[model samples]
Target chain A: MVAAHALTVDDMREVRAAAQGGRFFALFDPNALIAAIARSGDRAAFAELFDHFAPRVKGLLMRGGASAELAEEIAQETLLAVWRKAALFDPTRASASTWIATIARNLRIDIARRETRSRLSQVYEILDEEPPEQPDATLSGAERDARVRAAMTQLSADQYRVVELAFLEGFSHQDVASRLAIPLGTVKSRLRLALSHLRGRLEDLR
Target chain B: MSAVHRPSDETLAAFVAGQLDEGLALVVACHVEADPASRQRLRDLQAVQGALLDAADPVAMASGPRDVRAAGQGSRSPASAPSAPEAGMPQVLRPYGLGPWRSIGIKVAMRRVVVPDAEARVFMLRAGPGIALPHHKHSGLEWATILSGAYEHEYGRYAAGDFDEADSSHVHTPRVDPVEGCTCIVAMTGNVLFQGWLGRLLQPLVRL
Candidate 1:
């Protein structure tokens, strides 16, 4: 499987020290791979994650309006950030993909502005420290992703449109209203209703 | 279910999408950092964002994993937290530039705090113990979070880590708590207009 592709002696020092070192039959679980990277700075696992996610992130960034070159650069930066911040990944709080998406979002903002993003996380990155992790009881990344996808499909077309504009494409409520030729109240209500429905479906995690 | 004033769900959604202006995001970040419930909400919503990303059509990258890995080498630098200038100030605001505190009214003082990329003017408002400010109404959005001590308006008392939002529709005089006084970070969009005779008297001389 994916684990088999990572057994090569990429980093001689980390061969047996990593979780992926001898487990040829091990599944390519992103969370487990991330833990292995954090546990031993596993390059192979990082490579696997990058291979699995970079193109996806690049595509997503392009969809969000980044140029191909910028999207490619941002995707690479996102993964590098992933490698750097693997230790901060909390599976219970957010899945690897979700965390990666957050990283990508931060990078896209920074890259778009072409400046040092004053986002708190950037400062934390400079400080090389994060606030103490708070304990959270929630679904794992994959399960949460599945649930969110299921919930999104249940939204009405109008509600989904609002979500796509307000969330996926990062439109403001006023902008979403203008884009759809709908009233501001309708945009806000649709967003509220959609988020509530998705939030209700996600309540089992609590 | 009960908590101090927090940003609305729509606002949080915008924050999650990286769509909020920097000043508003900072205020919300303070609230989210202080409140675990909001933090969880942010994560839950981000997962949905991740799902949306997953559905995007894949594009081929010009560079491969090896190229990314190679480029990432030697990019890691040691990160150190800046020495905090004031106690009880939220960590999110510790990195930006801050100006000296300036006295404006009898007990109220204001200081400029720069938030990079912020459209709204950000500042720190510190008041002496048990002082009542003149009643004023806002023109645009105003977000204030207590960093130290407490303040009470018509709405309620807000202590450390408490967030208060006032729009043009919100008008009230905020009185600092007697014992602790108050220090709050405020991000305001428009001017604050005084409510009474003070409106015509101090409106020109006093600045918030």
Candidate 2:
């Protein structure tokens, strides 16, 4: 039973090798749990989701520089949001981790809004939540998730770091630049190149 | 109809990454709303973010599962439709109150969009047919989304549903469409310094 996670390049290589030549990866089913909660307001399902994600969400926040208290507050808030906004989840479009992480990221942006004065408040803009239906709707969430994982492994190390900082870490380009010790234009170009590449690869799914 | 112009990919990536501030995000969202292509583009970028999240290291929540579940009491009733604001504003803007339109220049009317805690001041601006906005430059970044009609500047033409952005370094005059005029939702930091002596003399009169 291969767990459905790859935290480093070596792991990603192994995952990709397994994924190549059409092997099966029996992953945990967070989507079904979210769907169950959405359908029946299932407390059991919510508890399971909490057990699985609360810590990971908190960890993600802490990596981006949130305090333990702040990360805990937001993690709790994020899980509670999972309970409240479960109905909005579209299993066909995103995995449970993606949907829940998007929520946590939005809540973090809300914190950023409260502290600093910037243009970031656009949460719950349905455009932020409702993915326009994909060109092809038949793709399973896990299949798409795996395809994305494959694409990540394809990116050059420099390219991948930019994507990771901008997306996973939710760092502003300026923050990414300073953290990577690269020029702002370099950050922008790398991200632009990375996204264009990712988009091109994912477009095959559509 | 779809927009011919959209926010830059870097901006859209930032928008997808949850880095764009509320005002700029709203502007890009309007374009995303109006353009299917942009919407798909954002989805593709977000897919990568989601995959990265799956690999993110776990930082244990201080509280146990049961305690974290207790954060919100009982059921939150479903949200109702927001109060109606001015028509022609994006559906997302319905919750925010729109100030009355006040004329700032010949055939120009502007109104504030009260985005709670938004540091960037935003406004809905209308320019009459064939009218050119005063030549000006910004002290900070400015993002505008055309709601209806069209406008043009040295950069290019932005029609209904289009998004345009300019920063301190950009200085040019923009004109309302010749026949239809234009109304755009704009967000910006700092002030607009109207260019030229005539613009300076009238700056006090044209503060938006």
Candidate 3:
């Protein structure tokens, strides 16, 4: 039985390896995969998405200071959420990657907050039990995304660093300051400038 | 819509990253509901985050359950219509199960929201026209979003859709406009420390 299980694991690994190689040829479009899952509970489409996003989500959570085990758990949960919320995905509003990233971030936050609440229940009383749900925003088109991407390249090195630390690593302002060995005020100003520049470049979309 | 006071970029970014505490996020959610411009900003920020996700280096996931067939079977669809808020209540605050409003001062009433994981005390405060709240400073973060009417503090006038964020460093005494009473949802992290003789005298009587 143990030998059979090992053989099954090896077969799965081979399948995944083949899928990874296929990425170079077909360049899987997450948007189309999401649409497939939404229209019909397409297991193949979901497998493709799971293969591509699960690991990236895990990496992001790990970078945000979660333990490896916790990160993996959240990553799986994030994909589960994507599957559950697929019908709500309006491709025109957001790309699949962005939507999935949000699910991962929110799950991590929920877990962290729950732990904190349990630890500090005696000192701090939280009255509301429900988590805050993300608002559905209408995202711009692909053209706007390209423009915003172009605008990002125009940010100063310092500004980009702040944005990277804050957004990608989920660092707080103080965390960014201490990580970069800069004053807290400096971190704040740099981040503010970066956001303002990006907003200005994308204002025409509005 | 243009006049609606939006949260700062940092706060909004924090909201996008899911880093803001639940209480503060709720206030931002309320603002986003009333203001389309802020919602647009949120989308823009989220798109940027999406691009970041795309650029991230992929890590190899460990082999696990390969069954994707029953993945979402037990999950409810997200297409269902959001339940309508109680009459005269904002949709964002409907989920909290607010308590009965009790008189906190003359022509002023407040109701506490039951948020289980929040370090902050979330509540709704309503003041009659021309009523003035005693001057006070917060021990930590204090976030208030105006629901209706307008109030003027030392900082400036805050009207409907305005989100006022304050910390321990700031102090203000707000007065409602005489023409219209003001109602606000507030999430406070720490106790309020009243300033001056009158404020100190009233502080003991004030439960919030």
> What TM-score against the true fold does each predicted structure earn?
0.80, 0.82, 0.82
lDDT of 2 by residue, A106-189 (tens): 777766556653334333545655446544653455566777788889999999888878764457889999999999999999
- CAPRI grade, predicted model 2: acceptable
Clashes of each: 4, 6, 6
Residue-level lDDT of model 1, residues A1-206, one tens digit each, is 34643544344325445656465433446776777677677787788788778898998877666789999998988888888777777775566777888878877777775674555455424322333234356566567778888999999999988887787545678878988999999999999999989888888655
Clashing residue pairs in candidate 3 are A126-B115, A127-B114, A127-B115, A128-B114, A128-B115, A128-B116
Question: What is the DockQ of the complex in model 3?
Answer: 0.26
Task: Name the docking class for model 3.
Answer: acceptable
Residues B31-117 of candidate 2 have per-residue lDDT tens digits of 787777777666666666677667778886667755434444334333324566455567667556678887766677777777756
Candidate structures ordered by lDDT, highest first: 1, 2, 3
RMSD to truth, every model: 5.7, 6.7, 7.7
Better of 2 and 3 by lDDT: 2
Best by lDDT: 1
lDDT of each: 0.73, 0.71, 0.70
Per DockQ, what order, best first? 1, 2, 3
List DockQ for all candidates.
0.41, 0.37, 0.26
TM-score of the second chain in each model?
0.80, 0.83, 0.85
DockQ winner between candidates 1 and 3: 1
